[model samples]
Target: MSSPLPLVFDAPKRGLPPRHLADLTLAERTEAVAALGEKPFRAKQLSRHYFARLNVDPAQMTDIPAAARERLATELMPQLLTEVRSVECDDGATRKTLWRAHDGTLLESVLMRYPDRATLCISSQAGCGMACPFCATGQGGLQRNLSTAEIVDQVRSAAAVMRDGVLPGPDGKPAPGRLSNVVFMGMGEPLANYKRVVAAVRRITDPTPSGLGISQRSVTVSTVGLAPAIRKLADEGLQVRLAVSLHTPDDELRDTLVPVNNRWSIDEVLQAAKYYIDRTSRRVSIEYALIRDVNDQPWRADLLAKRLREHLGYLVHVNVIPLNPTPGSKWDASPKDVEREFVRRVNEGGVTCTVRDTRGQEIAAACGQLAAEN
Candidate 1:
């Protein structure tokens, strides 16, 4: 009899490599190295190279004996991703890279450098299952959950680029800065790949020599209101910020814009957001994409602020994103007057709000637009 076909919802599982250095804890890394017939202490050296130095080239590993470097490189430091193409903007301050995984699974990540900070936006999944109509990543559907290493590798590469003065800015010089922040806001809904996303966060926030050691406060994980996952992350002892993508105020329009609303209504999602704030004391960010004639209205903004005050009180900030129209999509940003009025009404109801800065539109840097082009 033929084997049953894999479920349509099953995540892509073929391209990932055998468990490597990234999937381990400090102790586990030592154990893994010992298991490979090397001294356990060598694990620290490798970790220092990978995490502290962001160096993956085993040939330059002088600390490890010349004889053993080849074996370790062959066994431990196998290439996880190869850069396919890189699109840059803002005089190279913003860069988006398309990567082909070991088995040819395609994924993308963006790195941006500014005067104050360098931020790397990486994908947690190859594609997303959340069918938010306006989002390119969601419309592509779920391909597979990216491995924890795959997620971490994106940050490592961006950090390396920043360190090496690769990205040029205006006035034709490399911006002297290091990666200061990371956001899992590319190509997929991070929470949908729950376990791996959390693991990636651990690897990101843990102190260097164990991981990249970025501050927990600098990491932001965004979701389109995955209720249970929101509650679970609150209990994870992580200080990372939580961003809820609530495209509309009421259940009526949100149900159509964010289909996940069909399962969990506006009230249920807000309650969960409240739970996060009560438990963590970290401000939750509400993401509202302003689409013309759809959910952008003065009264809807009033209702959004009213409900947020009634539920979450002062523990939330609403980030209004002016819709960046895809090629032929009817949805577009609201006029300046409409947007200002909406913000005024929201502030009148006592909730803080601001418009998000648009970056990389010239190169289709808004979420899944790049993936769609490829």
Candidate 2:
């Protein structure tokens, strides 16, 4: 049979059900509550539960009227996700959750508690369409883009876990009772789901009575260098960090590594990255996954550093990641010595560089692995 047609990038879309508070903007939330025959002030109280306190339980909303709590919760806070399974590793500091949505779609997100902070890696789509050959999620193909509420719910749940003292750090503390950072480098190409992703960012950064109060600076939105989208985000004037997953420096090899590079050349991607740096005054992060004998050469390292110097200037930082190999894939991480050499060359060229810590490998918590099994 012929392959089925793919999802059109620009087709008019209907979002996920409104049970999720994250899908609604502040004004929308006000209107929804007002529609429920409640006063406008109820919207502010609901916002506090969803954002500031990070709790959605009607029983805990003491400030709200006892008679009105059940009605409000039923109308505003229907559960969107059911936990499928949770895998814990790193001596219990890291936990990856596989969730089944209300529609029975499987998706994954991770919560990691560190000494200083807790971070959550959230997915933007049910599966990915990017089709990067080395990636497991790419092989599965796209299921659909997640709604804004689906994406934000991941953070809300993780934040609630941290606050409840369920996740502990090395010192056995409750990891500060708040989520410190959020990374968008999970399953999908976030920029591909542009409107929802941007909406999610606003929900995450807005102060209480509107959305979650997380600092915009603490959020990192990653993409595989969607050039036009990169430029568009720069115009947003928000301070959230931007990460460009430039797996390889040269277009000749990257064309195979990241197929999207075929449409937008490396030069165009870097130039767009420069615009982000100039506009936001925030350092752009370059994520390079080190694979054995491929894109791991010292020469490629030097070229990567040189390119950053030319296009990004001082507003760039390199995060070299050890490739987390799929079960039967031909690829594996580069040798430690080679990995160190790659870092050395990039630093010598006068750009900041470091190897990213590889975590949750045993449970397939690394990027591109979760969606593979689902």
Q: Give TM per candidate.
A: 0.95, 0.94
Query: Best-fitting candidate, measured by TM-score?
Result: 1
lDDT (tens digit, per residue) of candidate 2 on 1-374: 22332433442343455566678887887898889898878888888888878887899999999878788888888888889889888888898999888777778899888877788999888777778878877776777788888898888899889888887766765454788899998888899999899999988888876877889999999999889999999999789999999988999999889878877889999999999998989999999999999999999999999999999998899999999888888889999999999999999999999999878999998655765676
Clashing pairs in 1: 12-144
Scored by lDDT, model 2 comes in at: 0.85
Off by over 4 Å in 2: 1-15, 173-176
**Alpha-carbon shift of residue 110 in model 2 (angstroms):** 1.2
lDDT (Cα, tens digit) per residue for candidate 1, span 1-374: 22332223347565566576787788988887898899999989988998899999987899999877777767777788899899999888899999888877778999988777889999988888778888877778888888898999999999899988898744569855688899988978888888888999999999989999999999999998878989999999999999999988898888779877777778888898899998889999999999998999788999999999998999899999888777877778899898988888888889999988878989888777887788
Q: What is the C-alpha lDDT of each candidate?
A: 0.86, 0.85
